[model samples]
Target: MAQYTFRTRSSDCPYELAIGLVSGRWKPRLLEVLKDETLRYGDLKERLKPVSDKVLSAALDDMTRNGLISRTAFAEIPPRVEYALTPQGESLLEALGPLRDWARTENGR
Candidate 1:
């Protein structure tokens, strides 16, 4: 994956920054899945079937690094880890509503 740097410049477009944040193949889908509820790693792996373990782990790490998601780990016999969207992530999802509507309308749904 290519590294992206978001610079705070007057000429920098906010749209680009937003797009960069959710630019991965699995990111938007992951956000949608996380929108409804907090899920464990295994649960997410199961829900997003056919997604390889390495790719899923990397995507989760990237999302977490970008502040789009939160990871919580619990100490137990088997260990527990959960993922959920952050406030910024939720806001991003809400912002996607219009885009979603536009796509649906374009598709004549």
Candidate 2:
């Protein structure tokens, strides 16, 4: 486990806590991509084409800080790093299913 300073008062409200965990430009999209398998930084960036490096990096960092994702760095001459959902993040994805279904219903899907 690691400690971090949250940008919001997450401990004060459940809504804030939930939002703070996943609200960002590319968080939901990133989560969807990571739901199935682990991916290296380059692979993730490729899958998330059109997302600038800065944006993706920030999103990954925020998610990592919140315990939503785990980052594994490998030692090698050319470094390799992989990102995957943590248990908490998998739970978040499971919780999102109903919300997604609701949105689809609203959209008449």
Best by TM-score: 2
Q: What are the per-residue Cα lDDT tens digits for candidate 2 across 1-109?
A: 3333354324656655676677776898888999999999999999998899999999999889878889999999699899999888898888878888999999999
Clashing pairs in 1: none
User: lDDT, candidate 1, residue 69?
Assistant: 93
RMSD after Cα superposition, model 2: 4.5
Q: After superposition, how far is residue 45 of candidate 2 from its true place, in Å?
A: 1.1
For model 1, residues 70-100, the per-residue Cα lDDT tens digits are: 9999998799999999998899899988888
Off by over 4 Å in 1: 1-11
Model 2: pairs clashing at backbone N, Cα or C within 3 Å: none
Q: In the order shown, what is each candidate's alpha-carbon RMSD? A: 4.6, 4.5
